[model samples]
Target: MMNSREIIAKRVAKFFKAGDLVNLGIGMPTIVANYLPAEAKVMLHSENGFIGLGPTPAEGEEEKDVVNAGAAPVTIVPGGACFDSAMSFALIRGGHLAATVLGALEVDEKGNLANWMVPGKMVPGMGGAMDLVAGARKVIIAMEHTTKEGNPKILKSCSLPLTAANEVDYIVTELGVMEITPEGIALRELASGVTLEEIQAKTEANLIIPDKIDIME
Candidate 1:
């Protein structure tokens, strides 16, 4: 069986198509780069000023100067370009990204996202998340189903401060893939070995289950 993070990343990678200029946010979202289908010609973007970002560098092959927005060493594909922060944010805010995958602390049925910081916790100020969510053509959230304390992250409404209001397009968790539809949060697929009742019990949001639910590969 795939691990929780791998399962989430694998499903999230399926969302991208050829020619996509995608951005992977700091944590779990970055893992999606390693899982992209070999045939899918996607260009990964790093907010720290690199486009055509490649998968995580292999052990012992790390380059000191080449890194992702998270400061982790990463590879750059052929034709990748590097520029300064001004140009990077310009691309983000100018709506050049095809999609952005980000990890969220909480997401509501209305597509509200809250990922930057928790109350009173010391955190680096919200980086490009605010701009990426608002500017990307599509915003996909890659997060665990619940917090470490086992509390649901998908809620009826976010209790944490908002990162972006109603900006999330799709949410992929270990349990399944959900889409923020006009009707509500729609449960589009279920992971292997997961049941509908278990998902419902764990999620605070009332998921709109379709008559036919597809199982995630």
Candidate 2:
């Protein structure tokens, strides 16, 4: 059976296409870069001002200025280009990005995202998520099925602060892949070892399981 990280990687890989421009958010979202198809050329856009990005830099070889939007150090591809942060947002806000993979705290039935601050806990600022959700052609969220204590992240309504409304199109969890529609999360696919009833039982929100189940093997 695939672990949580591997499951996220597999789900991300399925979304790849040739000549697509994509942005990967912090943490699990950043892992998508390592799984992208080698044969298919996908241009990676970093909100910190680099396009055509590569993987994370080696240990002890970190560059202070060369980092991702999350401030984590990164390595660039041979043909990579760097620009100002303002100019980078221009590309994202101008709708040049085809898709974005973001990590979220909570995703409601209406496809709203809440990833920024956790209120009293003082989490990371909203950052570029606002623009990414509103501008990207498609926004996919890559996260675990539940919280550290096993509470579901997919909910009927988000408890944390929202980043955007009705923005998320797809969501990948260890349990399954849920396609967010105007009404709610449509159960389009499930992991190879998981079942629709199992996922629904684990999830805290109402799930719309489609008649046809696309099992991701």
Candidate 3:
């Protein structure tokens, strides 16, 4: 069985298609880079100003100032280009991205995203998520099933500050892949060994399991 991070990354990778201009958010969502299918060619855009991102740099060989939005060193593929933050955001706000993968703290049934801050917590501010969620052609969230304290991240409503409203197109977690629909959170696919009952037990919101199950192997 795949580990949690690997499970989430692999599942998220399934959404990528040919000719996609994608942006991967910081933290766990960044791993999606390593799992993208070889047949599906994608151009990775970093809000920090680089496009056509490659793999993360090896340890002890880190180069200065070559990084993703998280400031971690990353390799640049051929044809990659860098621009000022203004131009980078222009590309984002202009709706040129085919899909953007983000890591969220909470995503409600209404598809609202709350990923920027946690009230008293010292978060680094709401970076470019507000723009990405609102302008990307498709917004996909990659996150863990629950918080460290076991609180479900998927809910009927978000309690924390919101980054965008009704913007999530897909959600990939360790347990499954979900579609945020008007009716509710739809369990479009489940992990090989995960069950609807198990997902229901852990989820706080109403889950819509389709009549047909697409069990991911």
Candidate 4:
């Protein structure tokens, strides 16, 4: 059985094309940087002001000054440039990013994303998430199927503050891959050991399953 992290990584890697300028958010989204094909020309963008990102480095290779949004030490690729956080945001806001992979708290059927803050829960600031979702050409969310207590994270509507309303394009979970559309979520793939009925039972959002389901595993 594939663990949640591996499942999310595999799904996220499928969306990339060569030469894409991608922004990887704090958590699971950062794993995709390590899994992409070596020959693929995907340039990573760090919201803190760096381009030409690379995978997490070895223990001895860690650079204290180089980090992803998650604050994890990461290796910088050749020709990488670091600048001010403000300028980095300008790049995102200017639509310089091709895509951004973000982690979400909840995702609606209409592709609305809520990842900023959990209402009533003490947490850090929302950070640069708002800019990433708004400026990227495509927004992909990486998360698990349910919360720690076994409740769904994908829902008909979000319970937390929204990062972007109707802006998400794709969602990848341990259970499957869903494409967001104007009508609702389109079921694109189901993981091994998962059935459409089971997925529907576990999900809170309205799902549009195809006549034939694609097994994502």
lDDT per residue (tens digit) for residues 1-217 in model 4:
6679988888798798998888988778877776788788888998877998777788898888888767878878986888998889988988888899998889999788988787678567778888888889999999988889989888998878888888899989988999998889999999988888888888999799779878896
Best by lDDT: 1
Model 3 per-residue lDDT tens digits across residues 65-112: 888777778889887999999999889989899988999899999999
| Order by lDDT, highest first | 1, 3, 4, 2
Model 1 lDDT per residue over 1-217, tens place: 6788999999999988998899988878878878998789999888889888887789999999998777888899998999999999888888899999999899999999998888898566788899999999999999999999999999999998889998999999999999999889999999888999999999999999999889986
* TM-score attained by model 4: 0.93
**Model 3: residues >4 Å from true position, as ranges?**
58-62
Candidate 1 global CA lDDT score: 0.90
- The ten-residue window of minimal lDDT in model 1 covers 117-126
Q: For candidate 2, give the lDDT.
A: 0.85
Regions more than 4 Å wrong, model 4? none
Give Cα distance to truth, residue 210, candidate 3, Å.
1.5
